[model samples]
Target: MRQGGIVGPFPSARERLGNGAISQSANDWEHRYRRTVIMSDTVATALVVGGIGNFFGARDAANWHEKWGILAFCTELLVLGALAVSRSWAPAVLGQGADEFRRLGRALFTATVVLALGGIALTSRNIKLWIFVAIPAIALVTMTARYLLRLRLHRQRKAGQCLRPVLAAGSPATVRDLINRTRKFPHLGWRVDAVCTTDGLGLDEDQLDGVPVVGRLADVAGHVRRDGYRVVAVTSDPYWSPHRLQRLAWNLEGSDAEMIVAPVLMEVAGPRLHVDAVLGIPLLRVSMPTFTGGRRAIKGVVDWMGAAILLLLFAPLMVSVALLVLMDSRGGAFYRQRRVGKKGREFTILKFRTMAAGAHGARGELAGRNEGAGLLFKLRRDPRVTRVGAVLRRYSIDELPQLFNVLTGSMSLVGPRPPLPEESAAYGPDIRRRLLVKPGLTGLWQISGRSDLPWEEAVRLDLRYVEDWSLALDAVILWKTLRAVLHGQGAY
Candidate 1:
C-alpha cells in the first residue's frame, strides 16, 4: 500500500504531454517544478508515520483486522490519486505563464481540501488543526522552495545555452511570427537554427533575424538529419496539406527529430483538446470546459482548507499588516472590489490597499497615461503607488488579505487570475474564458513575468490552464509563483 501510493499509478514519463514546438528551456524554473517529488515523499513519509502509530495500537483492532487494512488501503489510494493528478499539472505549467500552472495547483489544493473536509464530515471528530497546518505548510514550503530552484535552472539553460535547436517549417508569415515568439521567450529552451518553407525560400535567405533559411520543405528531413536538428515545428501554413503532412511524418519517422504541430486555437488547452482515432484516421477534437460533480466538490473543499490554514498561520501578520496600512495611508487597509469569477459570477476580490482611498474613482485621471497592455491597466512605474504601498506591492504582502477571499468562497488558492470588471469588459468573448475558474491571488500571469506580458498572451495563458487542470500543475505553479514573488519581477 505504501509503495504504490508513493508511486502513483500513471503512465510513465514518455507517455506524458509533449512540450509542443516551444523552444524555450525551463532551466531557470525547474527547481520549483521538480520539488513536487520532495513533497510527495514528504506526504508519503507522513502516511508511513501514521501507519506505524496505528501498528502499535493494532491490538485495539486485532479483532477486526480487515478494518485496519481497509483504512490503510483507502489512505494509499488517496495519496496515489493525488500524486497522479498532480503529475499532469506540474510539467504542463513549468516555466510558462499562469494558466496551466494555476489550474494544476488549484486541482491539488482542491483534492487536499476535499479529503480533509470529507474526513471531518464523515467522522464527528473535530478537524485537526495540526494536520491541516502541518501538511500544507510542509508541502508549500517544499514546493515553493523547489520553485526557486527552477528559476536557477532557467538561468543555467540560458547560460550554458544547451537548448534543443529546431528548424521552423511553415509559410513565411506564420514562420516569422513563430520565430519571433520563440526569440521573445529565451527560457522556452529551443534555439531556432533555421527556417524551412514549403517551397524554396522566398523570405530573406540572408537572415530570418540572423539565422539563414536553410532549404525548402523537401529538404527538411535530410537537413535535420545532417544538421542534427532535434525538432520540426509545423506552423499553420496553408501550403502543407494533410497529404503532404502525412508524408512528412512518414519521412521524419525513426529519426530523433520530433515533429510538432502548433494548433491554431487561441487559448485552448489540453483538456479541451481531444484526439479521436476514428476508422484509422486520428481526428483532433476539442470540448467546452465543465466544472461539475467531482471538480466543484474538489474546488470547494480546497477553498475552505487552504483559507483556514492561511488564516490560522497568518493571523498575527495580518494584524501587523493592517496596522501598517492604516499608518501608511489614509484609507482602508483591506481593499475589496468586484471581480469576475467562475462561470461569470461576480465576487468581491480582496487586496491590500496599495492606492489611495479614491483610487477607483480616480480612474479617469490615469486613463490618458495608461501603459498597461490590452484591457489590464498597468504602468511599470506608476505614480499612484504610495511609499508604503510600493513596499507592499513589491513583496506582494498587500495581497495577503485575499486569504479571506479564499476562505469566503470568492477565490481559490490557485487558478486563472481574477480579472477586474473593467478588464473583463474589454475582453472579447473568447478572452472571457478566463472566468471559467475562480481568480487566484498568485497565478501564472502573476508569476510568469506578471505585468511584463502582453495582454493577449496573458489571456491565452489563463485559458490554457483552465483546460488542463491538474494537481501537479498547480503544485508546479505554486512553486513558480513563490519564486516570482521573491524576485519581484514585473511587480509594481
Candidate 2:
C-alpha cells in the first residue's frame, strides 16, 4: 500500500525530511556524550595511575621510566582495552540504566585481575601498590565522573532535550499505556513522536494521546525508515505473530532504529528474566524470584551494619527530635505501633511521635477526609499533627528510629513497605507476595512518590521490588532515597 493510503494523509516531503533531523540530533548528542565519557574515563585512569606512580617512585626518579612509567602506561592501556572489550562505551548504555556502571565495574575488575596475574607472572613486588590502591581509586573516580555526567543528561532530558524519538506500534490501549509511561518517566529518554496502531488508527482516528498516528503496524518499519525514529517500540498485541515479528526485525535491519519488543510479563525483570533458545525457538525464560540465598544473607548483614552506623551518626539528631516532639505534643518521645512483617508476623514498628496523644482514636471521625491511597491513611494537613511533627515527617526524620528495627532484624534497610495488620489482612493472594520478604524502612514506594502514588501504583511498585530484588537494585534505591527525602514531595 502507498504510504499516503496507509495513513489518511502523509506529511509533505519537507516535513518528512525534517523528521530525520530528530534522529540526527539524537545521534549527535549520543555521540558527544559517549566521547565525553571516554575522555573522562581516560583522564580519570591516567590521574590515578600517574599520581600513584609518581608518589611511590619518587625515591628513584632517574629509574622511574623503567621502573614505573612502563607499568603505568600498560595499566592505562589495559583499563581502556577492557572497557572497549566489555562495550562499556556503547552509545545505548552511555546515559541510562545501571548497565553502564555495571559494565564499567566489570571492565575494571577484568583489568585488575590481569594486572594481578601479570605481576605474579613477572615476580614484581611493586605491582602491589597498583593492585591495592591505584585500581580502586580509579574505579571510584571513574564511577563518580560517570554519575555526574548522567545527572547532567537526565537534567537535559527533563527539559525536553536529548530524548530518543520513539514510534510505538501496538493495539491502541497498549500503545497509549506506553505513551503514558514514557511521559511519566521522561528521564528514561523516550519521547513518542508518532504511533502506529493495529488498524492504522487509535481511539481518536488520527492520533493516540498527543502523538500522531502514522500508519498501521505493518507500516511501522516504513515509517521508521522514512522518519528515522531512534526507537521502534513494539508493545504486546495479538497482531504481532512470530512470523510477522520476524519480518519486522528483518525490515528493521540496517536502519539506525532499535526495535524493542515488550514481553507479556511486564512486572518481572532484571536478573530474573533471561533469553534462551530451545528447539530452535527463542524463549524468554524467567527464573523464580529468590528469597533465600547467600545474597539474602549479605543483604541481612548489610542491613545490620548499615543500621548500626547510621544510628551512631544520627544519635544526636534523634535525641533533639525526640525532645522537640515531647515539647510540641502530648505524647511520648517515641510512638510504637504494631505492623505486619514477613511471613505475616507482627512487630512493633517505632517512630518519633508525629501526632496528638489520641490521634488513633480520632481516626474514625476523619475517615471521610482521608487522602491516602489503598489501605493507607494519609492527611496532608492533619490537625492532629504537632508543629514539630510536620517538619519531622517532611524530612522523614520521624522514621530515623527505624534503624533500631533494622538493627534488630525486624525490618530491612530496603524492601517492601510494611503493611498494618488490617492492611495485610485484606491483602489478596497476589499482594501476599510482599510478605515473602521482610518489610523495609524505606522501599520502592518511598522513592517512587510515596503517598502521592495511586494505591494500584504503590502496590505495583512493591510487587516489582519483590519480583526483581537485587543487591544492586537495593543500592540504587538507597541512593535515590536521599534525594527523595530532601525533596519531600509526597510526605504527608
Candidate 3:
C-alpha cells in the first residue's frame, strides 16, 4: 500500500521505515527504562533496610552483623523477591495510572507478611521493628521514587520520546477517536502512526485525523509485520470475527507488537474487569461494582477520619471565611442546599455562602446567561456572587464546609459530585449510577477541569469514577486535587 498522505508533523510510515529509527526506539527505551527501575528499586530497598539495621543494631557494634545484618539482608531479599513476583517492574504499567503503585503496594504487603511469618518461625524480636517501621518507611521511599521517575518519563513523552508506534485497525470513527485520545494524552506513551480501516479508507480518503490509513482490515497484520509497529490496537468493528482475531494474534507471535482489543465496555475498567478462559475460549467477565464490602467500609472510615483531621486543620481558615462571607453580603455566613446523596437520599449540604441572600430566587433571571454544563446552573460572572464569594469559589475555599458532611457520613472525601434534587430527579437510569455511592468533596470532575468541562465529558468522568473506583484511584484524585485547586482554571 502507498505510505504517502500521512498528516500532521509526525513522521510518515515510509519515513519511519527508511531508517528504522523510531521502530527500534520503543524497544531500546523500554529495555533501558526497565533496567533503571530495577536498579532504583534495588538501591532504594537496600538503603532503607541498611539504615534501619544500623540505627537499631548500633547497640551491639561487634555483633551487629550477626544480629541485624542477617535480618536486614533477608528483609531486602524478601522485598525484591516480592516485587519480582508481583510484576511491579512490568514495562506496560511503569509510567501511567494507579496500577504501578498498586503493584508496589501489593509487593510490600507480601514482603511484610513473609517477614512476620519468618519472625515467628525464628523467634526474633527484631521482626516487629522491620514490620512496623522499616517496611512502612520503605514503602514511602520507594513509592516517592517511582512517582518521581514517572514524572520524568511523562516529561520525556511530552517531548516526543519513549513512545510506542501504534497501528490502529477499526472503523474510521473508532480510529479517529483513538487518534484524538493519543494526541490529547501524550503522556500515555502511544503515538498512532498508521491506520487500517475496513476498506483501507479513512474519513478523508487517505488520512484519518492525520494518521495515514495504510491498509484494509485484513492488511493489519501485514503492515505490523512489515513496519515493526510496537502496538496493534484493535478497536471495535464488525470485520474482526473471533477466528480473524485469533489469526491476527497468531500472526503477531514472532513480532514484539502487543495486541490490545478494545472491549465494547470501554467505560468500565480497572479491577472490575477480568479475563476468564472458558472451554478454551477467552471470555471477558465484568464484575459488578461494589457499593458494600470491606473496601466500602474502609472508604467510610477514611472519609470520617480524613474529614475530622481536615476540619481540625482548616478550622481557623473556615472561621475566617465565614466571617468574610458574613461581612461581604446581606446573608448568613453559610449556605445550605438539599443535595442528593447515596441511594438517592436527600441531605443538607453546606458551604461557606458564596452568593447573595436571594441568589436562588434570582437564578431565573440569568437563565439565558447560564455558563454551566448540563443540569448545572452557573454564571461565570454572576451578579449574585459577592467579592469574597468570588475569591472563595476561585480557590475552592467555599467547599470547606463539605468536610462536615463527610464527617457526618453524608459524603466522602472522594466520590462523584453530589447533585441537586432536580438534577438527580432528571437522571436517566445509566446516569443515576452516580448515586450508588456517597457523593464526594472532590472527584474526577473537580480535578479534571471543574465547571469548564463539557456536559458529556463531565458525566463521562463521573461515570468512569463510579465504574473504576478504587482506594488507589481515590488517593490519586486527592493528590491531583491540590494541583487543580492551585491552578483554578475552571472555577467560576
| Candidate 2 local lDDT, 1-492, one digit each (tens) | 112111122232234556576567667677777888999999999999999888884345354333788778888999999999999999888877767777888899999999999988877778888888888999999988988888877877776677788899999998999999998898898888898988898888888886789899999888888788889999988999999999999999998899999986667888888899999999999999999999999999999999999999999999989888888877699999999999999999999999989899999999999999988889899999988989999999999999999999999999999999999999999999999999998999999899999999999999999999988788778877998999997998
Q: Against the unseen true structure, what C-alpha lDDT does each candidate score?
A: 0.66, 0.87, 0.87
Error of 2 at 259 (Å): 0.8
Off by over 4 Å in 2: 1-19, 54-71, 123-128
The alpha-carbon RMSD values of the candidates against the true structure, listed in the order shown, are 8.9, 5.3, 4.1
Candidate 3: clashing pairs of residues:
none
Preferred candidate (lDDT higher): 1 or 3: 3
TM-score of each: 0.71, 0.91, 0.93
- Per residue, candidate 1 scores C-alpha lDDT tens digits across 458-477 of 87777767777655556566
lDDT of each residue in 81-153, candidate 3, tens digit only: 9999999999999989999888999999999999998888777766788999889999998888887888777
> Least accurate stretch of 10 residues (summed lDDT) in model 2?
1-10
Best by TM-score: 3
**lDDT ranking from best candidate downward:** 3, 2, 1
Model 1: CA > 4 A from native = 1-152, 265-267, 379-384
TM-score leaderboard ranking: 3, 2, 1
RMSD of 3: 4.1
Quote the lDDT for 257 in model 3: 89
